[model samples]
Target: MNATTVSRLTSFAPAAISVLAIEGPRTLEFISKCWQPNQGSSVLPTNRIRFGFTKATDNQPRFGCNESIVVCRTNHERVELHCHGGKQASEKILETLSSLGAMVIPWNQEPCLLARDPIEQEAMEDLVHANSIRSTAILLDQMRGALSRELKRIEQLNANGKLQEAVDCILQLRQRFAIGKHLIHPWSVVLAGPPNVGKSSLLNRMLGYDRAIVHEQAGTTRDSLMERTSFDGWPIDLTDGAGVRLASEASDPIEIAGIDLTLQKAREADCVLLMVDPFSGWTNSHDRIYQETQGKRILVRSKADLQKATSVPPSLLFDAQVETSVMTGEGILELQSAIVAALVPEAPDSGIAIPFRTRHIELLNRLIGL
Candidate 1:
């Protein structure tokens, strides 16, 4: 073999001779008959290593298909076999071992084995289910005791009786956890506005695809449609809800109900994008609807291309506003950046630790009160 291959083979050789305890009434007879190793090594008295050929009950050779395994008897009553990794080959070996009265047990179930720490276990689960590179990194760090180490430090400081300092540190970390939790699990952003205001159009722009129906008809979207999209590494649950409107003579009961449901969803959302046509400005109806949404709200001026001016008017004052045109894909990038800036800011140097679970938040709150 080449140098590299020899080095790799040598590295794996020690681990290859794993000791598997075979105990039963037929253990000694089976080991004496089937145990054969290709290499010639003297078998020690009580602690012996024998190179051997394995065969089926029919006396057909099974060693040709499988690599020759090492059978070692380290005790008077039991034998150990080091076998290959294929499932069928392992199964056949195991069946042979069992027929010789060996009791099979998984390595993980062995007593006196060190159990994995909770954080390590959680990390394994996170790695298995992680959907993004950033999330996986965060989870791996957490599994490596990043959060647990911090908690332990906090506990130590508190034990020294620096209660106020400990409290302050935990409180700051909790704030970070809030943002981190959202980063790991995106919050819901709902678009709610009167019909024909380009809500659906904006939805298509945000998702970079036509997921919702966009038409001139006022009540075209009578039900909410949801799409998952990410903005600057932060996952977002973007929902295009049925347009809200004052109950009119022509409005059917179903349409009215849809509007009410849309309003309710807006009230419960993490952020509400109240879309309006810039050319039309904010109408009295828009003002009334805006007053009803309880969550974080931002005014989005749609159809900016049709507007005579590009700037926000002096009379219109809001926390934030974005001018966008879904038709030409203008200001979409700016809108996405603004959304990320507003919702998920960069983590501070002190490190923000947001709870990944409701249980964590609840426990934190209890600890805070104490």
Candidate 2:
């Protein structure tokens, strides 16, 4: 082949060979010999068609076998074949292509096939095993050019020599992306408080099922019970820990282990929901837990329906409170909305690109610092 033809051959060889393409005046005739209609009347030279074929037996071609093959032609210049989607069939087709002197390439290296942009690629990877609809949507949106647009904008600004403005925009977007990471991935939210504060009930309510057993008995949930759920389009890993309490002789070693685990989880959580029984008011233990939680705390007053009025009073105990009743479902929606608002603050603006990975975040942080 001449150099020009060789380049063309190289460009189209991989995909064409994989699909068993044939190129010659007699290509259609060759295909017709091996092709037998399985679902349609005839295989057209200009359209894609499926059929079946078998080895010749006693001077007769097998009409139909266990599998069907699809054939198509493009503008009379190339013919394509799609065999059964099985290992053996694919191998046989590949062998046939090889015999025809067609070049073969791995599927990933085929450039003629549609390719996803970087953001789209990342989004596809993110959504492959997404745990929530919200996460899926976020990935889909990102894949659909959200990140590309932002990066393009930055590039355009940089090309224009608007260094300060470009840097500012990137910095802001980087911050938003940091928060968006938690939304796209599962975030730990530890439910902790004194014993019998309905932490387990709240956990079950959030999960929309009895994932964690609840009882009137204190310390019924002697260990941490983890349930996965989504809140406000963010994947939340909810953990109902054994209520924080002073260790006693009656406490099982397992229960003590659970408390230790709870404290560990508390330290690692992105947010902490400190449950308090409104009827009993906050105690010293609650204060201790709250102090330990520092500012990563959202005060959730459980059993709100049992109160005289379904409202949080302006007391030190009620400060920054979210009232909730697992039984009556009051304030659940509000609490969820509040949690989302407090956590994410706002949805990322359209065309704003944020890194979705910790590595990206660290790199961006270093970039900013420099």
Candidate 3:
């Protein structure tokens, strides 16, 4: 309990600032060795942020000692260091602290010391991985005890002999868990179709840039290229998979492997954008691919600009169809909307309690069973 502990509270990636927490009996002794305040005393003022630059100690080298930093003594045994977010600055500082007998721990391990409960700790951990603003908002609510308050309400109802009411509340939370589960794990949307179709073009258009290789040649994309993007505030991993064709037509082994990989990604994706054009109209191969995916699908009629007064096929049954021309940027927004609607048909209201973790869902299921 008396040993000093040092942990980085921010992500390891480069940012505007990185936070490091030093706690335990030796916190002040370690802070004094590295940080030199601009004014007043080297002694850190309790709860006040002091501007300083880390200086080299007798035992440590001066490699990253000159970086500007700010320190705040949070409590009797806790001090927060705000330093440059670049890897070198933080790493050197942590190295200095570790060399001075401070225990260096992972950022994730620091949450348990600060969070009041497991739910809040999980929320804090998930916040670092949140890809979209919407997901961050939900995790922020959870961190602020939104889920904890709901659980308490359920407990209160059950204690008062309102068993049915408590069960109903747990059921609602369980239903909301569907959205919570996707907060950290972005939805996977795979673009799949035959060669010469505009699958890659549509993926590039949706990404607002050229990420996948778009070519006139068939099978230009020999492998799956995945790019992460946000549509309507929901994080989506859009995969431009290799063109799926019959084994007899695909002569190369690489293409066959890519085709197999495409089917695998399709099977795992939250939704598959089945692209087809007038030249390569929906065929038996496309049907087989769709059947293999066994998931939500949206038919994309690509290269509409080339379809000059072409007749539409009536036999194709699909959950939804969007006619798009990447050249004209047509139907792109509609496609994005369709994808979001397909993945998240009903979004939970703001401040609603959501079970973001697997344990939360399990607990809710157990409560409902009771």
Question: What are the lDDT figures for the candidates, one per model?
Answer: 0.64, 0.64, 0.86
State TM-scores per candidate. 0.66, 0.70, 0.92
Q: Which scores greater on TM-score, model 1 or model 2?
A: 2
Model 1 — which ten-residue stretch has the worst lDDT? 2-11
Every candidate's CA RMSD = 10.1, 7.9, 2.3
Candidate 3, residues 25-119, lDDT tens digits: the string is 89899888888888788877699989998888877867434889899999888999999989888888999999999999987776345657778
Cα lDDT tens digits for candidate 2, 317-369: 42246889998999888877766666676766544465676655565555445
- Tens digits of per-residue lDDT, candidate 1, 92-184, equal 665665555455565432221215655445554445445554556666666666666777777788789988888887787677675657545
Report the number of the highest-TM-score candidate.
3
lDDT winner, 1 or 3: 3
lDDT of 3 at 42: 88
Lowest summed lDDT window (length 10), candidate 3: 308-317
